[model samples]
Every structure is written in C-alpha cells, then in structure tokens.
Target: MPAGELFTVPPVRGGTKPEGSSRNKQKEYQLVRVKNTWCRVECRQEMPTTWEEDQVIVSQAKIGEQVTESGVSWVVKAPIYFCYKVIETQNLLNPSNKTLLYGHVSDPEEIDEYQKKTQKRFVVMDATVEQIYGSKVRKYFEAHNVVYKILALETTEETKSMDIVLHILEEVHKFSLDRRTEPIIAIGGGVCLDAVGLAASLYRRRTPYIRVPTTLLSYVDASVGAKNGVNFCNCKNKLGSYTPPIATFLDRSFIQTIPRRHISNGLGEILKMALMKHKGLFQILEKHGKYLLDSKFQSTNVLDCNDDAALKTTRLAIQTMLEELAPNLWEDDLDRLVDYGHVISPELEMNLLPALMHGEAVNIDMAFMTYVSHEIGLITLEERNRIVQCMQNLELPVFHRDCSFQLIKKALAERFKHSGGKLRLSLSTGLGTAEIFNNVSEETMMCAFAAWQEDLGEHST
Candidate 1:
C-alpha cells in the first residue's frame, strides 16, 4: 500500500542520503508557538504505518493515511471505554446504605457535592416492586432530601415495548433531569431494568442509568450486562442497544420478597452460565437447587441456619457472566457462548409469551441443545440427561409443547441469518465447556428434536 499510493515524493519522502544526515535532522522539526508556549514539533515526512490483514485494517495506531486526488482518507480512531460498577450491597433502600444515592459517584469530591446537593432522581420501577417497597424507597430518598419521581409501570414481557420506553422518556423529559449529574434509577426485574436501560440510553443520546435488581433473575442475569432492549415485532430484543448502566446495585435481600416460582425461574439463567462455563457452579446449582428455591435465596445472614450458599451461587453466576460479557459487550464477535440457550429461546419465548417465563423458555432451548449435543457426539447421553434432570430439579420446564421441530428449525434459521450466516450454535461439550459451531445440519436438529421430544414430550407444558 505504501508503494502503490498516489505519491508526492518531495513532501512524503524522508531521510534522504545526499546532504542529508544534518539536513534531515534540521528538516525533521519545526518550531511552533501556541498560547504563549513555544515547542518543537516533529514533521514526519515518511510513509504512513498501518497494519493490514487480508486487505482489511484490523487495528491501527494513530493510523496511516492515503490521499488521492478526489479525497483525503483519515481514520477517526476513537475507541470508547465504558466502566460500570456492580456492587453487592445490603439494604440498598435503607437510609444507612447510601449506595442508592452516592455510590456511583467515583470522585470523593463529586460524592460530597452530590450529598450536599438536593438530588433529583428519575426512577423507573416495576409495578410489583413499587407495591412492595414503594414506602421504603420513598422514605430513603426523602431521608436524604432527594427530589425524586417514581414511574411505576407494569413492566412485564408483554409490556416490554418501545411505547413504554417512550412513556419513560416522556416522564423523564418532564422531570428535566441533569443528564450529566443525575442518573436515572431502574428498580425492578429484568424487564423493568431492560426497558429503563433502553430509555436511558435513548434519552439525551445516552444518559447514565443505575440498575437495582429486585428479582434473582435480574440480580444474576440482566443487571450486570450492557445489552438492553425492548421486544420488537414479535422478536426478542430485536430493538435494542448495547448501553450499560452507570452502576448496578445488587442487594440480595431484595430477592427475599420474590415468589418461589420466580426463584426457580431465575435459576434457569444461572444454570445457563454454569452449563456453559463453570462446572463448580453447575454442581452447586445441582446440589442446592431445591434449597435455593425453598429459601428464595435467603443467605445465612437472613436465615441464620443455612450456609451462605445463596451468596456463593449469585456471586459465581455474576462473575462467570461478566467473564463472557465484559470483553464482548458490543458483540464484535458473534461466536458467543453466552448465546447458548438464547438462540432458539428468543423465538420460542416470543411465541409463548405470558405463558413461559424468559428463563423457562431459555431452559427449553438449552435442553434441546443438550440433546443436539448428544446427537452430534459433542456430549454423551448421560450428560444430556443430567443437564435435563438438573433443570427439573430446579423446577425449570425443560420442554414446552410449543417448541416444535419446525419452530426450532425456524429459530436456527433466523439465528443463522442474523449471526453472520452461521448457526453459531453454542452447544456444551461437557458440563461447563462449549463451542460455537456453524456446521450443525438440519437433519441433526430434527433428530435431536425427535429424541428430545421422545424423552420429555409427555412432561411438556
């Protein structure tokens, strides 16, 4: 490329030999003055340095440029770095736990300023959460003299839409927030977190939002990630952006109020991370699945008699999920193992909306993928059965009647089309290791579905 460039030799060439060494040194720099400051600036008159692979630029530092008669080519090499905090706090809404107020403020001076200021916060909460903790949340903010507006919506899978995002935007607009200083707070389940995150990402072209996950599902699965969206046109997360929160405050005590079924529902997601990356986590879920469900993730701090299995389980789930998500937040690489159950689950969940919880649909997808793994020799039948049994033990439905082979095929097709023309099927080879394969055949899918159906069809709901 350096040789083939449209050249201007007198200007571009450097380090000429003839009458050069001292002259070149003299020509290499020029004195410049700006703002009462005088300094020497190097005039580099050489070929631009660039890294190219397969005629495509992977990365370049400060960039090499090529100038043609028609235009000047320069890369605007600005890479974005976003740092968000995930704090495991206790009694977040309690007057003493100031994390809900000043935790996200990084600088001590900023925190002091934030505390001194009568803060105005815009809160988007799930209706269920508002009903349960509205008084405490209100009292906490009021205790600090924070001027706040809480918009409690019936945020469910059915209500995960852009219209709700607009509703949040309208309320946020009316509140007239300081986009830089005051961040929006989202307090609820995954759906509420997602919708509020999307709204925050949209308003002012990306304002900061804080996540307060109330359910176990949100605490482990949704609250930590950057991806946020509302379901669009019968597709799961079809309309979304990769915008993370300024901070995610995880208070496990909030999980205590959730129903027993919701606890099991959340385990489906934790199971996903385990089956993909951590065998130890899988075993923990395997051993304490029922105990967790029974206790609703109440740690020994609350239950006193039980061990701190709840803390370990949630902490492990979050760590493993972050291990996958932090590097690939924008999904620059499509071969994501975190997308294991997500492939077919999106379609299946949309198809069976209101009937199946998000994690249940994801479990069904994982169950079938496990069987597919067996069929393709990626996993043994015993391993597949064990995974399924674990699902059952966790009270997660492994089979949904609506998840037909045709639906599976269609979901894979959609995934293939969207995921750069590859299935990118994240199938587990064993308990905690997985690979993304693009070579899965339709025949194998049908066979796996048939076998999965034969094994668990009668149990389908």
Candidate 2:
C-alpha cells in the first residue's frame, strides 16, 4: 500500500430534498484518505456547491472543470487536494484500522480475569500510602491465573528521587523471568503510572503496558497519553519518553477510596481544562461544581449522583479535550491547544516537588496566568472575577499566596534560562484560544503574582 492509494469518504446518513422546484436531489458524499484504502461515503441529499462547503467530498475529490450557477453546471479542472501523505505499507493491508480495548477496573477479580485472559504479566506499582488497596490487587492477581508483582513505592517527595526510581526499575527488570514475551501492567495513580511507564519504556527497549488508572487525575489527564517519564534532579517529568500504553483501563470505582483532598486536586485539573479551552465545558463544570464538592467533602460518590450524570459530564469533557489535544502532542505548534496552565505548572511542580500535587500547582498556575491575561488587557475584569470564582467554587487554590512569591519568581527565571530565553508560558487572550509567548516580561509575571497575593490576603484577613 502506498500513500497515493489511501482514501476514505464520510458516510452520509440522512438526505434532504432540493429547494425551489429543483426536481433533482443531488447525492452527498465524503471521500477521505486513510493509509492505503479508498472509501467513498455517499448520501441521498443535495450536494454542496463549493469545496469549502463540502470538505468531506473535496478532501478526496479530484477537480475537473469550472462551473457556475444560473442553471448551468460546470467543473473547475484543478490539482488533487492532498491533506496528508499516507504511509506506504509493504502489503495492501488495512493500515487505518485502529484497535481499541475497553475494560472496567471496578472489581479486582474482574481485572485479574482480564489480565489472565490476555496472558499479560500483572504488576501492581503503588504508593506506600495505598498499602491496603495494593494488597487487594496482589491478592486478586493470585486468585486468578496471572502472575503478579508488587512494587510498593512511597508517594512522598523523597520517593520521587531519581536514584529511587532507577533502583525500582532495576529491581523489576531483574525479577522478571520472561522479559520478551510478557508485558507490564500498572495499576494506580499518576505517580505509579509514571514510574511503571518509565520502567516499561526501558525494559527491552520499550515493551507494551496496560494502564489501570485508579484516580480521577489519571483517568482524565495522565494515563491515556503515551508520555512516560520520571523526574530527574527533582525536576517534574524531566526524564520521559513518549511511549503509549497498549490499553488504558479506567475504573471510576476506585475513586471511591481516594481521600477528599486528592479528589479535589483532580477536579482542579479538570477546572483548568474548562477555563482555558472550552467555554461549554466551563458551563458543565459550573453546573456540577456542587456535586463534585459534595462527593469529595462528604462520603457521597459522583457515580451515585443523578444516574451518574456528573461523572458522565466530566468524562465527556475530558474525552473531548484529549481528542482535540492528543493529535497535536508531537507537533511543535504550541499555540494551537496546549494552553491549560501546564507550561508554568511543570516548572512550579519541579521547584516545589514533594510539596505540591501536580494538579494543585496547575490550579495556582492557571490563576496566575489569568491575572497576567488581565494585566495585559487580554481579558476583562469581569472575566477574571468569574474565572477566580469558578476555581474557588471547586475548592482549588486560586491565589499565589499558597506558595512563596519569591520562590515562584526564581522558578520562572530558571524556566526562562532553561528554555534558552524562550518564554514557554501557555497564555490565553480569551477562552477557546491560547498562545505560547516567549516575550512575556519578568515585570508582568511579578505583577501577576503580586495581585494574586493581595487577593489571597484580602480573603484571609
């Protein structure tokens, strides 16, 4: 299969009749190019008059001749529109067919059964804080036919030490009897995923792994992407590789056991996504903020609320965000859609590692960025107030006073230096648009932090 031969057209579902005594109802269709397959999708409806109006058709349609209205049909002879070059395969196989694996992690027994059926090695990497749950995971694996291993690492700042991570990986590698045939499966939160993902990436030069993301943060943000890495020299995600997992098992069931603060931390990340990229998403979060808060503060679970509508809403928003952003993960077009407060968040996490959860740092970074947006006149005072209020409603830290301003300034300076004077901050002029600017001034950052501090003091006193 060659790049020149692949095409796929959109499948038109319903049809509409033509207007104004036009007896002939034109058929609509979309032609898209996959790897090496040519597919034509057609519908019984009026075809669009222009290429811009019918992208699905124009994507694969080769032009003919010029045409005009006034009861005349003409075609414009033009070159074929090539959106992307399809990869050439050795054989004419279905190269565009993606395999998806979905499973529930609600029951450890069910998870163990799935692993046994898949014939993959089940390894439970967990935080020492979650000893009981980790034990259950091990027990479930034992009950089934799957071989299991438990690497209990502490989630504290000290455990994120580079030497500790490396040692853990070494141990896992050394203990494995059959490295080539067996794949690794990790079950836990972001830290567990990161450590296990890093180890999987290194073992046998990148083996496949299945991720069972237990926490909300991992479910919505971390585990889906192929990015696998660990911290280096106390820097957050400094050492990492873009190695995607074979599959990700999202079990909202485990979220019931998470503490209130951790759950709130995850919501903080969710709120950041809503504020920066999707206006509709913001509305959804606004509607469900109370539900999430109650779910965390009380023993109530989100799954138990209103037919699980809150969880569904949150999952939908997260899925949309991932679909929009994941495709652009490797592309260097930073300004397109990476503007969810992660730029400064990483630096802050690195500087304040073991002190702040990643989502907590992101929450603070989003507030600071909003303040910068206000200072630069990119956003109005009312919008800033609304953003701050939304974060407060979610119980996320919305002020810079949560951390030392001087330390933050120093970290920003270090970030600038590390990126070779390029200000890699994800700033937004308004909702649904983000720009990565390297021209942000130190004075602008200082002013933003100062304003945030003032707001925090006012609230406290």
- Summarize candidate 1's per-residue lDDT along 1-461 as a digit string, tens digits: 25214222235354333322333222223333433444433446422234122333222223323343334444333367899999988788899889998888889988887767789999988999999999999999899899999999999999899999999999999999899999999999999999999999999899999999999999998999999999998888889999999999999888889988899889999999999999988999889888889888877663332357787899889999999999999999898988878988898889878888988888999999999999999898789888999999999998888898888878878887888876788989999888888888889988988888888998644
Among all candidates shown, the one with the greatest lDDT: 1
lDDT of 1 at 97: 86
Model 2 TM-score is: 0.67
Candidate 2's residue-wise lDDT over 1-461, tens digit each? Answer: 34212221223255323332353223334454334444444533344434343334335453221112233232322332211111111111112211112122335665465545543354645664246466555445454444556666664444554565577667676666355445576767887787777777777777766676667777777776667667777677778777766667655556667877777788877776676577766776677677766664232344453455455555655676666556765434445344466656776776665677777888887888888888877888888888888777777776544456666676677666766666577666775455666777878877877777777544655
lDDT of each: 0.84, 0.60
Instruction: Report the backbone clash tally of model 2.
Output: 16
In model 1, the Cα lDDT at residue 153 comes to 99
* Best TM-score among the predictions, by candidate number: 1
lDDT of 2: 0.60
